[model samples]
Target: MQIKADSVEEYLAKVPEERKGAFARLRKTIIENLPSGFKECINYGMVGYVIPKSIYPDGYHCDPSLPLPFMSIANQKNFLALYHSGIYADEKLLKWFQQEYPKHVKTKLDMGKSCIRFKNVKNIPYELIAALCQKMSPEDFIAIYETNLQKK
Candidate 1:
């Protein structure tokens, strides 16, 4: 399901035409609501918002050459997927999202930790996703990341 694309536009072009709009909407929502200091780029073969090396010199622990990831979206084989560290790293945020999902989303919440899957356009929880995107600024994310590393 991973297609290597040089840019976000290139990645979007590779998506199935029927799913393009949903992915685009998802991407737009992330970018629009993304907190300051996170930059959008192609990471892990998907559209990603990350902390640039200029800000986080250590880079991603998994791949230091790449920037630290915060959020990302991609069109998968059967469903569009969203990955969010803000939701994954924070139990409170995850719980709040779970509690609010039924209030805002009519579709079943098919997710694993931070990965939220959407099979239909109407089922995409834009508000919930945006709220997560806005919950943490780059500074907040860095602080959490550093704290986690210390505990390890």
Candidate 2:
């Protein structure tokens, strides 16, 4: 679902009524456990956590005007989607998350390169997401981004 909102509150308001609670809790869990230096804002039409320009002035490599996006949560048409850049860029982190997912949710993991899809909102596994949020910091993300940048 494409939610055209300018703020996190606005985005939350647009979510389906059935998903409001789960989505809110998911957002809260991320915000609460998110490491220092990442800021929350509406990014790419979702609730995004990013390293602001003040911290990384170069901004996103794709779009210098926008902050470097670390993570984003979207209330998709069929499920809630979490896009974490760290997992997409860091192999160890990706493997760790993949291995840890089964312990948190009984259902088989449904994931993409960077997007983790939660088809059942009740089984969202907020705690695992919290742990994932705490796993990387802004500096760590930037270093990985730069390292990959060099490879490219």
Candidate 3:
């Protein structure tokens, strides 16, 4: 579905009816657990929780215009995509997440370098995801991201 949202509210409004509850819960979880300095918005047709562009003027590596330290949640044709900017690149965090959210890890969720794809929101371990978000400060997140970039 093409999204017409440029902000959080509009993004939520465009979400198909069947996915509203799941997306709403996801948004709430993210907001409740978000670290300081992160901003939420609708970007690239999805719900994006980001470290505002003011913090990292360069944005993400692939798209310099977009902000950094961001994660995006989207409802795809058959799955929910949880895009993590740092998780896929950090071996330590990946291992930690696996141990922290065993059920989700065991589900054989589709994972790219930083994207975790699941068939439905129910498959997501919201508590674990929230905990992960809460554990890191904005600075810590940026540091980790930078460290990973240097290694590449």
Candidate 4:
């Protein structure tokens, strides 16, 4: 489930062996499509891709010491989870993901405003996931996050 690890490598090591393959594949996709300025680290006990303070200075709005998060992927107890904060904050992006997920993922998607839970990890729609990863830049994500903060 929510295993604690200080680094991405440790987090991967802690994941159950059976799920490692799926995690590895997903991790590869995340790396392959992740935006240039986003750095990968372990956050919230999961793999998090973030825009570090070096680029965004202000860091994460929730915690200034941490980087601004773009996305995260985790191996849960009974399922895997992928979170897209950018998509959740934008209606059009969220709609696109909602529309495409069903077409790509053969299994029923268990999704929320920001989180996509995959109980059947092996068949995740990686192509869609990669596209989602590539949809925005760190700067764009920062702009959106700041805009949303203004609304609240």
Candidate 5:
């Protein structure tokens, strides 16, 4: 499932042909809808959206050498995955997404603390994903991340 590619374009090229279109569309949706200030790259082996070192020079607390990751999309073993840090950190945003998902897709939401799993590419609900991408700005995410770090 882990397509060991060095770049986003390379990663996409290695995805199974049956899934190439859906994954590409999902990636496009995130790139187009994400607020300004988030930069795209390959992070943790997935296509990542991050607050770059130029923006947050402190970098990720866990690894100061790396950018602060905001989101990522991966083609996993059984499904496509969207990893959004905002929904994991903010209760209100999580609740809103939980409430809205049923309205967008009939199937029950398959989610983890930060990962939303899409088992069916045909029902990826691109609009809902678009709205989710726009829900947090880099500043907003940085504030929340700092607050959580302080709590620990």
Candidate 6:
């Protein structure tokens, strides 16, 4: 079902009962480990953690008005999506995560340009995910994302 949430609370409210706990756990982990200046909001039908327009005035692609999220969490019909802005492209980070969190890696983890998809939240590696989030700085993320955008 399509979510109509305009805020984080509303988004959580719309999540199905079975996935509520998982979503809550993921949300808490993200919030507790999130970098400074980043704010959480619901965008693109997902719960996005972003470095507000003020800090990254240029936004994701230098677009002043955009939120330019660094990561996002969403409960999908068949899976939960962990959208990591540039983690897919950063081999170092990917390798680190894979090595550090073998259990999560063994699960159904789908790697994409900027997203990691899992069948359920229980399969997620909270420690590794948090570490990955903690390792990269906002500026580091912006640079990588911008570089990739230029290459395309």
Worst 10 residues of 3 by lDDT: 101-110
Give the clashing residue pairs of candidate 1, or none.
none
Model 3's lDDT to the true fold?
Answer: 0.77
> What are the clashing pairs of model 4?
none
Question: Which is better, 4 or 5, measured by TM-score?
Answer: 5
TM-score of 2: 0.98
Candidate 6 wrongly placed segments (more than 4 Å): 62-64, 103-108, 150-152
- With candidate 2 superimposed using the best TM-score fit, by how many Å does residue 131's alpha carbon deviate from the native? 0.6
User: TM-score per candidate, in order?
Assistant: 0.95, 0.98, 0.84, 0.96, 0.98, 0.87
Residue-pair clashes, model 6: 0
Give lDDT per model, in order. Answer: 0.86, 0.95, 0.77, 0.89, 0.95, 0.78
Task: Write candidate 3's Cα lDDT for 6-109 as tens digits.
Answer: 78788787777987888888778888998879888877778888888798887888788888846788877777777876576567777787677676455665
lDDT of 1: 0.86
Worst 10 residues of 6 by lDDT: 101-110
Model 3, residue 128: C-alpha shift (Å): 1.1
Cα-lDDT of candidate 2: 0.95
**What is candidate 6's CA lDDT for residue 139?**
76
- Candidate 5 residues lying further than 4 Å off, grouped into runs, are none
Candidate 4's TM-score reads 0.96
Model 4 clashing-pair count: 0
* Residue-wise C-alpha lDDT for candidate 4, range 66-151, written one tens digit per residue: 98888999988888899989988888899898899888977877988899988887778999999988899998888889999999
RMSD of 2: 0.6
For model 3, give the RMSD to the true fold.
2.3
Q: Candidate 5 deviates by what RMSD?
A: 0.6
Candidate 6, residues 48-101: lDDT per residue as tens digits?
Answer: 988788877777655557777788999877878889865776878877765776
Encode model 5's per-residue lDDT on 1-152: one tens digit a residue.
Answer: 78798998899898888889999999999999999999989999999999999999999999999999999999999899999999999999999999999999999999999999999998899999999998999999999999999999
